[model samples]
Target: MSLRQTYRLWAPMYDVFLKPATRSARAKNLAQLGRLDGLNLAVIGIGSGLDLDWLRLHARPAQCIGLDITRAMLNKAQIRRRDCPFPLHLIEGDAMQTPLASGQFDYVVLHLILAVVPNPAAVLAEASRLLRPGGQILIFDKFLHPQQKAPLRRFISPLLGLLATRTDVEFEPLLAAHSELTCVRDEPLLARGWFRGITLQKHPINQHPINHHKD
Candidate 1:
């Protein structure tokens, strides 16, 4: 089956598979978006609307767009969106291509989607293209360790990528290298830097230099 087809088969039970993230347990390691009082945002890969539960509490974005490759995912999201007090837009599209006007968003979030897509960089590049200058991209997913670029990881990661991920990418450099965006902060899982929550601000080249140094 194709990548999306795999998900479509599981779409009926997708929400049952995913749940309200445990706060002090597995959830603590994920991204913590403090507050979004007034932000124009778009979320790529809004799988099963799990993040929407958290977003409803944290942000009141003017326009919240959720895009994904699976139509069933969008269907579930649509049901969830109805309860949302703010605007919620759903689009069926690929990660590499966002059907949004360039330079139109204030904030965009990948929220762990990169780990499952076919082209991680292309997804991120599209994110940059869709954001207005000074807009930001927030990413949360598994990225390879900086010091330990093991041969084992290189081999295993791609195979895993074939099943459920796009790139077993080194996201730190990709976020750092872009002149239009700056990696302001990175929150890592306690023992491993493999999974992390990242904040990248687009354009004007500004950041206070986040310390991703291992503890």
Candidate 2:
């Protein structure tokens, strides 16, 4: 089955199975983004809207949008609207080709998306276009580190992709190639350091240099 079809079947089980299973990691990931109380935010690949509450804590519901490629996922996300304090827009769209205007959002939340999408670099590029200068994009997913070589995992990645997910994607190269965005935070979250919470920001050229200090 294609990624869309797999997610269609996975949508119902997502809130029940995946949500509880990854709750701690999810919370930890969102915490890395800090407080986003008054920003225009967009959640790329917002499956089932499980992270809506976190977005609500950082942004007004009206200022946030949940974009998903599959109709089934968006339909399930509708159930979260009742629980949201403000109105949350559920949009059916591709993360790689979002219809949102360029440089529109203050923040873009990319949770559990990079490993699932076919082209993560494209998604990041589109996100770069959607974010205003200094706007940050929060990423929470499993990615191979720069120095870590996952030979065994890479060999079995084809089997894993049968479930519409990729496990051996390395974030180092992608981020390194994107000159406009800079990594602000990269921390482990779950699975003995397999999954991580990483944040990247689109900053203006020749602006303040990124300080790699513990400040």
Candidate that scores best on TM-score? 2
For all candidates, the clash counts are: 1, 1
Candidate 1: misplaced stretches above 4 Å? 20-35, 150-153, 205-215
Candidate 2 stretches with Cα past 4 Å from truth are 57-62, 205-215
Candidate 1 lDDT, 100-179, residue by residue in tens? 88987777888767777766778888999988776778887777755665677678776766655644577856666567
CA lDDT of every candidate: 0.71, 0.80
What would the TM-score be for candidate 1 when compared with the true structure? 0.82
* lDDT by residue for model 2 (36-139), tens: 55457788999998787555554342378889999999998888777777667889998989999998777788998988888989998998899888778888
The local lDDT score (0 to 100) that residue 147 gets in candidate 2 is 77
How many residue pairs clash in model 2? 1
